[model samples]
Target: MQRRYVVVIVALLIVAGAGGLLVTGVCRVRELAARMNCMSHLKQWAFALHNSADTFPVERNEKQVSAFLSGTIPNADLPPEQRLSWLVSALPYMEQSHVFLQIDSTRGAGDPRNQRPIENRFEHLICPSSGEYDRSSRTWKSAGPLTHYVGVAGVGADAAALPLGHPKAGVFGYDRRTAIPNDIPDGTSNTLLLIETSQNPGHWAFGGPATVRGLVPESAPYLGDDRPFGGWHGNHTVWSSKKSHYCIVALADGAVHSLTNATAPEILEALATVAGKESLPANW
Candidate 1:
């Protein structure tokens, strides 16, 4: 009986160890999958932006584009959540044609035509590695208007009127250096475009102008901001390894690559300017 009891205890211990390993493996695999999916989501949006730029002239007036499109410039007139919210616009390209049709561009938020919830609860928007998605409520409150990706505007507010001046104004759109055509002699891959942003509620630190109305001041600390208990998982923050190491950027050549972060301040500054090619470091 004593021998049998000892054997049972040993077996239990082995079972527990195996279970622990299995759980650990599963978590790691899930995390990797989430990151890959996020990258894929970014690629889809990048292609969409490329297509939009192709349709619109690079040097065209920003206000004119907004007026022609009815105040829905992806990066210009539109707010952050709605600005880079190309998940609706790029639906067809990403094998989600049905969702795109649901968005009534003419109707504002409270319109009767806005029947289907504007927020997309699709698993694609939710990063499996992070807890941005509220599974119970089926909403994404971190960044406004139900989104997974974030935009990077190079030019500030005053510079939006200048050609390719403000790349950091809205989500997804880059400055002239990164957004314009490659043959134009003004472009760089190291400059930021759209990065994966954390969806923080109330204080949207990373959201662009569109989400400006709902965002808290950047002075707010991340401590009590109770979304989850982890560091930033996306490329926007300094904490992100993927972004600081090799950020995936869409280039002027209409190509995308994971670029090295070992870039000079001048290089980064040049990339921020619309006429970066004229001023950027030759070696960059």
Candidate 2:
């Protein structure tokens, strides 16, 4: 009887160990799949921005572009009337032409017609790793729909203060000038274009100029401010406080790269600028 009991105990322990390994493997696979999907989404966004620039060249200053696209110039002086986000302008290239057509260019993002598209949830814009979507907890706070990705505004002490027409060296600007390939003197592959965040300030269609200031460290404390550069996963301090260890970013060349929480803030800032003429790190 004693021998039989020992044998059964050993068998159960072996089964338990095998189950633990299997679960670990499955979780790893799922995490990898999520990362890939997120990268794919970033690629699509980069391509779409390129397509938009190709079709609508940035011929004039930021004010001119804003006037042409949104029928008004966005600036700190007139905060309430400022509308038209970069995402809305790129909708046609994103396979959202029908939705784009519905948007009234003459009206601001708050307009009823423009709000229609913003209110809808877009799965492609949501990061699967971020887990289930919750409209109630959007970063924009009832402004419109929420997004997990945002553009790098620029790298400087006053990055956030720059008006729409005069954006810093980043790929995207507020309803400002559209950046063509020629604008990025630092090489497209080396410049950062878009980044993922658990919390985003503007809706995909609202065109409120969603951007991240590269001044803060990638792993900086959140402080509940939605304007800084950071993510929900990894070392970022936002929403649920869970750590995912890495943040996803897309370069101007439409290439996706994974940035760990420990990546140097200087490297991130360098990548955020368009004409800063900075060199990438050895590993980057």
Candidate 3:
């Protein structure tokens, strides 16, 4: 009788251990799927950028083609704050032309006429790994469904003030930089285009934090905390296993790289510029 009881107890322990392992394996698979889905989203945006460069009219209204692909749609007479995001301009190429047409170009991105389009929840602009922000109520989300992704405003803006204009070495700026293909002194494959961040304005239809962000020192990724795009500033545990060990980014060449949290700050800077003329480390 004693031997039988021992055998039964051992079998139960084995079953419990196996069940735990199965659950863990299932969870990891889901995380990976979500991560890959997020990568696909960034890739689509990259294609949109490329398509816009080659197709947008050279003279849309007044400014030259460079001006249209310019990061902001600011009228010469308007303040930078009132400018529309380049994201709006790229909508047509991204298969969201219907939404793009809804926007009134004569008005600012925040105008009442643009509200209907601003509320659109673009699934391709979101990452499954950013589920913590997905929980926010529609009304509370204000601008629209949150875009966990944001443009890399360049590595130099890693200063105290947010430089939204000139000298933004990245691919974008406030109507100051051009998105023409191969325009950068640094090759497309060598430059950073976008990054996964939570330290943004959470909106996608406007400029500034809504569309771009400087890779400032405070915005380290995966370190956890609201240190910019590094990790969730709010509750990190919003979803099961959401803390990622690496930060994901898309290069101008439309390639994705999973940068580990321990990646040196200098390495990131090297990748952020278009004309910095910096060389990356071999081990990086």
Q: Best candidate, lDDT-wise?
A: 3
What digit string (tens of lDDT, one per residue) describes model 1 on residues 1-284? 99999999999999998997777667656655656665676666667656655555433444322100111224454444333233444455656667667766544433456445454455554444456666678765454444434344444443322343333332233223233533233543444344433434222112234322111224222111132111333333322334323334344333444433454434544454434444554566
Which number leads on TM-score? 3
lDDT of 3 by residue, 1-284 (tens): 99999999999999998997777677667677777777788888887877777675354345555312555676775554566777888889888889898998778877899888878877777666666435345223334556777777676553112232233367776655544443466667877787887555466777666777667654454234455554522222332555545567888887987665677776777777666778787777
Q: Estimate each model's TM-score.
A: 0.53, 0.75, 0.79
Error of 3 at 209 (Å): 1.0
Q: Model 2 over residues 1-284: C-alpha lDDT tens digits?
A: 99999999999999998997777667667777877888898889878876655565554444222111221225343342256566666677878878778877667767676666657666677776666454456442343456778777666644544554333446555434435455666777887878887654455544434433345444344222242443533332332455546678888787888877666667777787777777777786
Greater lDDT among 1 and 3 belongs to: 3
Predict model 3's lDDT versus the native: 0.66
- What is candidate 3's TM-score against the reference? 0.79
C-alpha lDDT of all candidate models, in order: 0.42, 0.62, 0.66
How many clashes in candidate 1? 14
- Badly placed stretches (over 4 Å) of model 3 are 1-5, 57-68, 76-81, 132-143, 156-168, 179-182, 218-225, 230-244
Deviation in Å, model 2, residue 56 alpha carbon: 1.4
Distance from true location, Cα of 283 in model 1, Å = 11
- Scored against the true structure, residue 262 in model 1 reaches a CA lDDT of 58
lDDT of 1 at 51: 63
Model 1 residue 45 lDDT? 60
Candidates ranked, most accurate by lDDT first:
3, 2, 1
In terms of lDDT, the poorest run of 10 residues in model 2 is 63-72
